[model samples]
Target: MTTRAWVLHPDIQTNRDRKDPQPALEEAMALAHALPGLEVVGGEVVRLPKAHPGQLFGSGKLEELRQRLTDQEIGLVLIDGPVSPVQQRNLEKAWKTKLLDRTGLILEIFSDRARTREGVLQVEMAALSYQRTRLVRAWTHLERQRGGLGFVGGPGETQIEADRRAIDEQLTRLRRQLAKVVKTRELHRAARAKVPFPIIALVGYTNAGKSTLFNRLTGADVMAKDMLFATLDPTMRAVDLPSGRRVILSDTVGFISSLPTQLVAAFRATLEEVLAADLILHVRDISHDETEAQDADVRRILSDLGVDENTRVIEVWNKVDLLAEEEQLALIRQAERREDVVVVSALTGLGVEALLAEAEHTLDEVRMRKELILSFSSGKQRAWLYDQGVVEAEQQTDDGFVVTVNWTQGQARQFHEL
Candidate 1:
């Protein structure tokens, strides 16, 4: 309900830096003002030296903070950035209060925002995995094992240990259930492979208008909001390109500068949607001052997920309608050297067609070329290859038939033995 956030400030110069911690502090206050049960009463920051890590704050500072929290009645100390589990434990123990890192708070938010069945499952999975490591934070006393045949008989007997044991079992069960979901998803992906629709996934920081753009292009009424994690479950809908060629557009979980690692892995199912994508649309909020820093965080997360750096990515600088003449022109020139870039305002439908034109072109290079030869006897099988990709050339032979097929890595393998 209340937080005494301990922030660690570092002095580092970067071209694209996130908004100052001051705004987050202010934003935290605003949130408490809006939410009935929440109060971000006060906070403190320790500006550590470049190489200092032992204790975020020296003994004197911790004592001062202890006194400040006592005066403020702070119930929680939210570390506004990454902290080691050890440091987190130490900080909470020293401050004699509950602690939450930035990641934990974000996961809590996602857990609160998820609406659909899939969304809920993903959020729970993330929350459990995150909580799994922080078991030491438990405040209640442990209970003994309980069973139906136990010597202890009770009508309303409570079992804390039994509840946790049940949770462990449920955790395993949920993992298996998620695996099933993933496998079923893989099957759907395989079917999509047969259809050969180029997947164009829209990814950006939360509330960057990804869903709005998705609805404009696909005509689906997905819930779009001016809130964090408005869209939790990835929604993929068919969008007709400028050439009438259909490609799937997926609206995924929006990225945040300090997105939780637990949530990231749990949302791997959703993020894998990006990995499976034919082209990644790095949508940005050009209107926001933190746009570039958000982009860097997104890129860093993508790289962690093994997304190829050389993968075909289209940078979409959205909200250009909100930009001034000089700013728009400057961004245009900045994006000029990039192979694929567009300035579009999803809200106003400006430059949408131009972006679609680039989409069509980007889809063409989704798969690299691999030439394969098939004999005349495999005519029907060769026809199947054409379904997956273009057939650059074909030929006839006396012994049988030699057909050259241009296909993807998977299709070429399928064509080799055909």
Candidate 2:
């Protein structure tokens, strides 16, 4: 049976930097809908002057919400912000329903969506870390005595302590396995690095239509849906631009505001493609009211992930099909006035050709000019440079030849290897 769930966004008035509560509540509802086997019956933004340390909600508010949840037969309550273990326990007991805070709910979604071996292991490790913190005394089972070997905790050890130890052990094992998986990924990256194609990464807020754009650009059938976090694993495909330039396009997991710290840390490897990208396309749901806020969140995450300040980025205003004709024209006009923005609608393939042409132009703009001297015996190297169409001018010299070439950083590196 599907679990009937209710969502709540605590709009704490004391937090001056809080996002607009209504949009935040709407996002929470979307997140609730993303998870399977859960029917979101209702959601609302609950106003509060401050949080109650033990229960999150005030007594009167808690009683009112409890009655409403009970009447609707809500079996799960999703709180749209951090909830301490004590607060979660107290709220669950008061409301007589299971509870999940933002971190827990996101973890659940990742656990369900993770498909690759590495992704599954990463989720398990993060979930264990989260579960470790929740091993409080409130759980009756944790109070039971555990018989332990003297090598570990002594006899009469509490089950909570034993459980924590077990989680630690599992974490250690997962770390070892993850190390192996990451090594394989690194090897794959090294191989790609030698392919002489610039990498272009697509990054954006969840459900911002990145996968749709990725499919449009590469003609690869990746899962593209209107649901939050529809794509979890990073996928890449080599695409040929109209200028005959081949580039690797990577579509990665989407970013969100107030993402769990555990997930951010754990998914760093998954997002390594973004770090290695020669150019980044920051896709945006231009029709959404909170698009600007979502853009800020994605940029903040890229910064937090140590993306270089000098890396080139282009803003892709996507989902223009969702807007009115006048709105789309206005966005197109605004984009035309900017050098680093492209207005597009991935769903209807609008402005995609222009996007590709712009990308080609941007890459061409980053090419560097270099001079190289080759000996008479380096005929193969000279031929390779000519084949790459990077040789601008060549002069025969006493040594052999002095060649001036215009190429990208990747091409320069490949020339050196040759």
* TM-score of candidate 2 on Cα atoms, chains taken together: 0.88
Each candidate structure's count of clashing pairs:
1, 0
26 Cα displacement, candidate 2 (Å): 0.4
TM-score of each: 0.76, 0.88
Which 10 successive residues of model 1 have the least lDDT summed? Answer: 6-15
RMSD (Cα, Å) for all candidates, in order, is 6.0, 4.2
Best by lDDT: 2
Residue range 15-47, candidate 2, lDDT tens digits = 877879999999999999999999999999999
For 94-131, candidate 1 gives per-residue lDDT tens digits of 88877766777777677676775666888888877776
Which residue pairs in candidate 1 have backbone atoms (N, alpha carbon, C) closer than 3 angstroms, thus clashing? 376-401
Each model's lDDT:
0.70, 0.90
